[model samples]
Each structure stands twice: as structure tokens, then as C-alpha cells.
Target: MKTKILFLLSIIVLGTTSTLKAQKLKKFGSSIEKKIGPKTIKVPYTDVVSYLGYAAPGNEDEVKDGKKFYYIYVWVPAVAPELGVRMMSPVGKAKTKNPIKSEAYTKNAKSKDYFDTYITLERSDIISADNISQDAVDSANWVILERNDDSGEMPKQPSGSSYNSLLRYKSDINDPLKALTVGLYRIGFTTYKTGEVKGTFLAEVAAPVKLPGVVMAKTIADLKAGMSK
Candidate 1:
């Protein structure tokens, strides 16, 4: 009888632990609340673009400050009052719903390897989509809008650390150099600690307004092609 009671207690403890873990993990997106007189209303993003990507061996796009970085090119079709970016690594069993998957990700989706993810949102000076070329991207004046390391709002990493990344950047209409206008942008990702960043990652770009025609790609050429379409 005592053994049966212990087994039941173990089950109850496990169920409680799982419930606590779920509570600690926040959703992938963000929301804002407005208090209208007496009632508070939650407003979620109208448009969210998600990408499922995998960073494999020798797949680093660039190296900055001695850290290897991978980039997901973004083309903003319209002006956005605010832009939110977030990244989760070792995607685990997180809810993807329907995300645009890259070839690399599809090929290695079953791999058990994952990593700690750090991310940045950067906007380039090339405002016109027609001028988004390899040379243009290389020479454009790039501004780092936001950088995030370990976000408390994301799911905890395998090491039980809140090492995911999230950032919200509001447009500065007065500052032409830092405004989030219709232009080419990119999400830069790497590891917070100086080491390899091989793993599957889920990234999302969201806007409060319904900004249509926004597109993203893993390469400049692919982004240009997506823009043309």
C-alpha cells in the first residue's frame, strides 16, 4: 500500500513540474495592452513572419567581433511603427504552426544538436527595394536597431538558462539613420558565448500593423528574388 501511494505521489509531482515548466515558457510573439478608460485590451501583432532555419557546420554567413554570425535578410514592404524580433534555439518541441523552412533546416530537422541563440535586428540604408543588390547590401550604411542576448521572456535553454533572444524596436521618424521604414533589413544570429552555433532555430518578425508584402530569405539574392515577386 505504501509503494502504491509513493507511485501516485511521483505522478502528481511530475505533473506539477511539467505545469510549472509550461508556465515559465512564454509564447513566441508579443502583445501590448491598452487601458481604455476602465478596461484593458490586449492587442497582438497583425502580421508575423516566421522562419525555420538550421545552422550547420561551415554554414556561417559572416564573422563579426570574432563571432560567427548567420543572417536572415528581410524586405519591409511598408512602414512599420514598431518591429519585434525573437529567436529560439534547439527548437525542441516548440509550436511552429506553419513556418517558412529553409533547405538546410529541412535536411537536418531530425538532428538532435541545438545551441544557445543570440540575435540582432539591423536595418540598412538601401531604402529602395530595386537597389537591393549584393554590392548595395555590402556598402549600405547598416544600423543596429536592437541586440538581445538572454531574454527572460523566452523559453529556457537546455541548460535551464533563459538564453533566448527577443527585441522590440520602434521607428524613430525624426532619425533617418535609425528609422524603421520601408527598406531592407536583416536578423543577425549567433551564440552568446564564443563558440560554434550549430543547431536548429526559429525566428520571427512581427509588426503591430498589417504590413503586407514583407518577405525574408536566407541569402541576398533570394531576398531580391522574393521582393521582385
Candidate 2:
């Protein structure tokens, strides 16, 4: 009888686990559909303008000099682009100026009007664009931005500008999403600089395109699993 009881308990646990996994995937599917697709949101136009700058990892010098900082663009569309009305920041910044072949990147990024060349505006802000840019109508990979101030101490050190751009974008876009819907996304970060670089990551996305909670959980799980293995 004890063995039979143990078997029954095992069956119950399996049933429960299976049910939970199905629910999780269902939730993930619903969330992904919302996020991985195109969408829009309502935001103070000022905040939208800030999204134009790319994400930064909040700077001591920026704060010291009083340059409002930002980067990292995530479109957690409340009702989404067609679903509802929302303001959009239309340009994307690039770590390199390759996509717009006609535009050339100048030697002095610090001294010149960088945005005029490297940064571009996309007609479309959707993921299929392959790169991020300044405008919504362009490619997904073109992250179009310039230092808020050319003179302030460099943000997130000199090497990690793209990463900072991603960060700023993510932080800026995420804030408005907290208010509504099962808002969805297809989020990522990549960066560029003027010169040839190796062993230098222009930028990297923080990971997991959907909910921050999901990203955090997966991160923790990956960490523990890595430590154990």
C-alpha cells in the first residue's frame, strides 16, 4: 500500500508539472506574440525624444555636467503601433555607418556633427530591419545617436558606448510599458564606433526580449546552472 501511495503521488506530481509547463508556454506564447511584433505606446513627447539618444548606464560626469542621459530602445507597445496611439522617437544610432553607404563617418566623432552621418531615421521600427537607426522608418539595427554633449567626460568609459546606447534605450523604453497590457517586444542591443575594433564589443543586449521578470529569472537560472556545472 505504501508503494502504491508513492506511485499515486508521483503521478499527481507529474500531472501538476505538465500542467504548469503548458501554462508557462501558453503565457510565453501570448507574451511573445505581443512583444515580438510591431507595436507603439503613448509617451510624453519629451520622453520619446530621450529615447532618440540611446541607452546609457547613467553617468557621474553626465550628472555632474547636467546632460540628461538615455539609450536602449524597447518598444513595449501599450496597445502597440496600430493598436493604440503613442509617440515614437524616429532615429537609430549605429556603431558603424555601413547601411547608409552614401553617408561617411568623419574622423573626429568628438568634434564633428556625428548624427548627420552615422545616425539615421527608419521608416519602420520593426525587427526585420536587421539594424537600429535614428528613424522609425529604417532598419532595426541602426541605433542613431550622438553624445548629448561632446565635451563631458565620456559615458560608460570610452570602450562601451554601444552597450551604453543599448542600456539607455532599454531603460527609456521599459519605463512606459509598466503601465499597461501584456505589452510585447523583440529587444536587442548592438553598437558601433568609427575605427576598426577587435575584442571590443560595441554593444550587447541585456537579453530576453520580453518581460524584465522573465529576463531576470532566466539570468538567475543561467548563473546557478553555470556555477553548478
> Which of the numbered candidates is closest to the native, going by highest TM-score?
1
Best by lDDT: 1
**Candidate 2 lDDT over residue span 1-229, tens digit each:** 9999999999999876653432221000111123334764323111111111222233211121233312223333222221111111112222222211111112222221122111111112343313323333223333332121121111222222222221122223354422233222322221233321111112121222322221100122332232234
lDDT of 1: 0.83
What does candidate 1's lDDT look like per residue over 109-164, in tens digits?
Answer: 87667777888999988889778889888888878999999878887766667888
TM-score, every prediction: 0.87, 0.19
- Report the alpha-carbon TM-score of model 2 versus the true structure: 0.19
| Candidate lDDT values, in order | 0.83, 0.24
